[model samples]
Target: MSLRTFKMVIAIVIGGFLIAGIYISVLVVERQGALRQISLYNPAWEAGQAASEFIRLEQRLSELGRPGSTVDRNEVELRYDILVGRAQILTEGRFQGLLERNPEHGATLRELQDRLAAIQPLVGELDRNPAAARQALDILRPLEGKLAQLASAAHNHGAALVQKDQQELVRLHWLFSGIAVSLILIGVVLILLLDRHNRLLTRAHQELHVLAHQDALTGLPNRVVLRERLEQGLAGLRAKGPSLAVAYLDLDHFKDVNDSFGHETGDELLKAVAERLRDCIPVDEGHTKNLISRFGGDEFAILQTGIRRPEESAALAARIVEALRAPFSVNGQEIFIGTSIGIALAQGGVTSSQILKHADMALYHAKADGRGTFRFFEPAMDEQLHARRLLEADLRKAMANGEFELHYQPQINLKANEITGFETLLRWHHPERGPIPPSEFIPVAEDTGLLSTLGEWILEQACREAAGWPRNIHVAVNLSPVQFRSRGLVQSVSRALAVSGLAPERLELEITESVLLQDNEATLSMLHQLRRLGVRIAMDDFGTGYSSLSYLRSFPFDKIKIDQSFVREMSQRADCAAIVQSVASLGANLGMPTVAEGIETEDQLRRIEAAGCTDAQGYYFGRPRPARDLVHTLAALRQPTEVA
Candidate 1:
């Protein structure tokens, strides 16, 4: 049956038991009253007491009748009162009822009462004259035998009443016993039902608690439970010496992995990583020495307690990083991912949020140092992070206030010795901080989701500026990786060309291998689409990234920009010169022009030019200048050749 119905039945049973108990109690009370009345009725003792008192009173009346005897009127009067009291007792209580049961006994009691009433008046007369007391005794003497017979009958009748009361009490006892048994059985069932309900309630509570605290995919503690655990641990160490450390860990290039693979693979990879992290720590019981949690995405946290020293924390962080170094096999393929950890130890008084913030700052610093490493917390990290946040806020507003401008660096042809193109570079002139380098603001732009907007603005402005330049001079603008991946890239490029009325042949888009690393197939497809638009595509920082040669075979790039690292060192290092020569030869054989970037000295330019470099651009040409200033420099350079 349903629980509600069962409860109703139990209630009804209990109510019935209550009613039965009440009925039993009332019956028991009634029986006890009958039993009490029967117990008090000792008909033989009362009748004998009345008869003995009458004989004693008769003896006293005879003494008063003795002639010349010492007259004792007081004794005679006391005996008369005693006899009257006893006679009244025989007529009262159960005795009268017992005597009525037998007609002979009842008639005998009535005749005795009439005889006593006749003697009372004579006794009162004898009290006034002692000689009259004998007359009262003579009247009661004949009825004494009738009174004795009545007493015997009363005694027999009382015995029957007592027997009847005992039988009723016995019946009540059996009925009460049955009711008590039913109540016991009901109580046992109710107790069992209540116990079962309590157990189910406990289990449901445990399940809800698990859902609240655990990560759905990884089965690790989520951020909410992690914070609660940290708070509890910190509270314990507050009064004592704090020997605790908090580590904030994040996977390097996780986004790249997610983009390259699928989200399903990413989720499986996270679960695998969580399991490895647990294995890396010491676990005596089910719980580890450290509480690990998936903070969010590829980010995780480890809350460590009972630390002996700060070095212990650093060692733990190192171990965690090395533990993740081993490749994880996901979907039957080996996927390598690195972990960067930031360690923050308790110093003085540290709250959970502050400790977490410090660890985050240290993690950012670790990334700044380079990924796949760990760093200890320091106060200066907060200051640097705060400055970065301020810069990011201002950078957001810079474009709106027109604080950004394009500087053109001339890319001069080695053979023609005239400016063929100018590479468009972005510069931010903050009103308060002065000029911010692209190195500083470009990463910030990418991180703040401002790259796409900044990229479109750069495209439009560069095209507009280059349109105003000499027709033979082309314009090259660097493209952020985010922009290339965006679906709006083709549309943005088309719009820029349309609005500026710049020839597509004179527009060059520079892309780094970072874009190629994200999704090669998609990146190649996008590059081909852009190539079909009739603009030139140059691979920027060509030799710095993986498979630089393989990428050239994947797409017929218009130009290969030799990385400045190889170009700047070519004059000093033979290896650098050999790399420069090989890249220049490769570009020539592929029917692509090679541009050696960052050429500052005559010797470096000569080395690249000897290596058959077709185009070069660096400080040796000229520093990037404003469009108006570039006109003067180009006019001076073209004085003799005049647009080649």
Candidate 2:
């Protein structure tokens, strides 16, 4: 039962006990009254007494029979009156109720009444003649038997009533016992429940404490604990302790691991890395002065105290790097990952925020310097870091400010001996900086999450620009890997095609092999979706990625653009020539065109044509040009008859 219901039951039990006690008490009082009244009302006692009194009246009559007895006639009348009055009491009230249940008691009472009536005449005559009273005494003798029977019946009925009363009292005793037992059991159950609740509360409080400080996956201290410890170290430095070192560490290419394997394996790898970090902190003679914590994802933090020199922190950083240098075996696969550590040493009353910022800046420098290394915080790094942040912020506003423009580079079809398509290249012309190289801002755009916006703008603008071009010529636009990850990528392409009034067949989306790296299934699905719209899809920079062959087999392509690196070296290197030849033949067999990129010299172009490359693009064709420049270039490159 519920607690409320149990309490109600307990109340009912107690109330029942109280009521039963009251009823038993009242019954006991009535039983006692019954016992006392039995002396007067019981036919047994009264009948015996009346018989003795009648016998005495007979003697009194005998005295009247003798000469000069002197027993008054009024005294004889009083004796008869006493015997009859006791008999009348049995016929009334409680005695009457008891006798009604038993017919023998009533019958005996009636017999005695008849005998008393018969004697009444004899006793009355005694007052008339004293000598006649002797004969009246004889009439009373026969009444003894009837009086005895009345006494016996009264005794049995009274005993029976008393026995019934005793049974009722016993029943009340059992009921009170049952209620008391139930109440005790309820109290015991309540106590047990309360104890269990208290234990659960205590355990939950302890778990909450652990959750506050510890990481669920790694069992290491989390960001909250790291912050507290870092602040404590800063406070210690202010109070005349050794200079402290706050190090920020991040795993390099951790996302690649997650994309390659599932998240479960990734989580196991994180735990493994956490264990290594914990083990990397060395035990010192004068008590350990390091606190390692997870700063979320693949980033971790360390607060190192008692650092006498910069070399100590460097050595610690090296240890962390070396420890993680070995490949971690997760899910039966060996995966190699690197750590970039940035240690910011105490600099004259350094606060926690300052150290955290400096350490993070230093980490960025370490990653920029090529990961798997550590960098210490330098005074001048702040200026460069601030500039990077400002540049990223400006790049975000580039799309809104209309600073982005697309330049087209011609794709030469060696077999047709004419320009087939112009690959759309994005160029950002800053209002203040004049012009910025795409290499400089593209990474920033990607890192700042502006790639999606810039990519969409490039798609729509390229389609719009390509709309007015000769219908025979197709426009090729590079789609970033980040853009393909968007759920609305196919819709965005459709909208661009719809708005620009460009035919899907005239717009070609160029995707590098890197786009297929993260999720092959999703990438293939998106490729199929674009193809369904009647648009052409080409795997650009084909041999650049590790799994170029696998990606080729995974999805059929409209065209394969060989990476420029192989094309630039194809004349000098036989392996490069063979690779280009093999790729061209492979594309022919697959019924897809092969486009060789970075063909600058005539010898390179002639050699690629001999090697069966159907199309080529590089500085030889022309550098990427603006739409105005491309309009004249396209008119000049068209067939002589069309030009006339």
Per-structure clash totals for the candidates: 0, 1
Query: Candidate 1 regions off by >4 Å?
Result: 1-340, 344-381, 632-644
Q: Can you write out model 2's per-residue Cα lDDT over 345-429, one digit (the tens) per residue?
A: 8788678899999999999989999999999898734554677788898898888888888999898777667788899999889
> What is the TM-score of candidate 1?
0.46
Instruction: For each candidate in turn, give its C-alpha RMSD to the true structure in angstroms.
Output: 30.1, 26.6
lDDT per residue for candidate 1 within 428-526, as digits (tens), equals 888888998886788778878998999999999999988988799999999888997777898899999999999999999999988889889988998
Q: What's the lDDT for candidate 1?
A: 0.82
- Residue 302 deviation, candidate 1, in Å? 15
- Superposed model 2: Cα runs more than 4 Å off: 1-340, 343-380, 632-644
Each candidate: what lDDT? 0.82, 0.80
Using Cα atoms with residue i matched to residue i, what is each candidate's TM-score against the true structure? 0.46, 0.45
Clashing residue pairs found in predicted model 2: 44-151
